[model samples]
Target: MDNLPISSKYRSRPLEPLGDAEREQLAERLNDEFARGGIDTDAYRAMLDQVFAANTLGEVASVVASLPAKDTFAVPVVIETGTAAPGELLPARTTGLRAPLLLVAGLGTGIAVAILLVVLIIL
Candidate 1:
């Protein structure tokens, strides 16, 4: 047993010690999950405490396991294809007073032309 390689000995180990960087990374992940509404305030505080108190990678893994899976709680994505069917009238984009103002202007022009024609005929 004493002659076994260090790697082989560690392979059977139940818990591997965690480094500062690993612990911080796990803490950050927990914080992100909390911010995304995956976990509640009580759960966040509990998990955060567990993250700091964890001495090994296995301990951190247990803490992570208590939270929801990332994909399960993630927001759904919506993609839109702007294509319309042939001859389909898509919704018109409006600038304020455009259609109404254009109609008024066109009618005014027609009325002025009619009045001018009438005056020219009378003269």
Candidate 2:
């Protein structure tokens, strides 16, 4: 019927002629779905307006189908590091020295302290 909305006709059959009210109702349904997903009402309204203005039933259906149904989730990401080069895998090098240097320093310190004490006693 000419008086009925286009959306209802479209729903019933693709070839059916659509009326303005049905188009508006379908747009509203799309907007409502988007709003439920936390999209701002004003933005949803604008999108609905665009959907309503679509000339073809296919275009209107496309817009309605585009509405997000639920919260979107991203896939977890993983970072991979390549293997180290031959010698580079070894522990870091220290500037001061290791066991040999520590032994020398310790002996020198002990001698220096002993000499100082002897000199003090003599004085």
Candidate 3:
């Protein structure tokens, strides 16, 4: 086999300083990755602190590069139509309608209790 010639030697350059917006964007990306379980809590916290402290874009990039690549998980899409038979039962929607109502009711009760307590304290 013939020996192949090396193309070009890589040259290292000084890292450019990161702007405020660029730093924020990188932080968001890292947070998203962490939310996806790409990195553990410890690693995420360390990396986040480093990202905030990083002055150069290269430093942030290095932290990002250390994390694993995002997985290509496919999300299933569901399409519902109101054409079901009258006698058929349908699955409950994931959206918690009752939960919000209950939450509001609980908050209202809590405020009323707090007001009553304050009135009793004053008297």
The prediction achieving the highest TM-score against the true structure is: 1
Of the two candidates 1 and 3, the one with more favorable TM-score, higher being better, is: 1
lDDT of 1 by residue, 1-123 (tens): 233334431234538787898778778888888898988999889889988997776566656565554443555587546788877888887688988999999999999999999999999
- Please provide TM-scores, in order, for all candidate models, with all chains considered together: 0.43, 0.33, 0.43
Candidate 2 residue lDDT tens string, 1-123: 333245443344655454687687676667677757756767677767766666655445545445543333776687545587755665566666688898999999999999999999999
Ranking by TM-score: 1, 3, 2
Per-residue lDDT over 1-123 for candidate 3, one digit per residue giving the tens place of the 0 to 100 score: 012113211112216776798678667888888898888999888988988997775566557566554444776687566978977998887766988999999999999999999999999
Candidate 3 minimal-lDDT segment of 10 residues: 1-10
**Candidate 3 backbone collisions, by pair:** none
| Model 1 residue 104 lDDT score | 97
Which residue pairs of candidate 1 clash? none
Looking at model 2, how many pairs of residues clash?
2
Cα lDDT of all candidates, in order? 0.73, 0.63, 0.70
Quick one: best lDDT, which candidate? 1
Please state every model's RMSD to the true fold in angstroms: 17.4, 20.2, 17.6
**Over 4 Å off in model 1, which ranges?**
1-13, 68-123
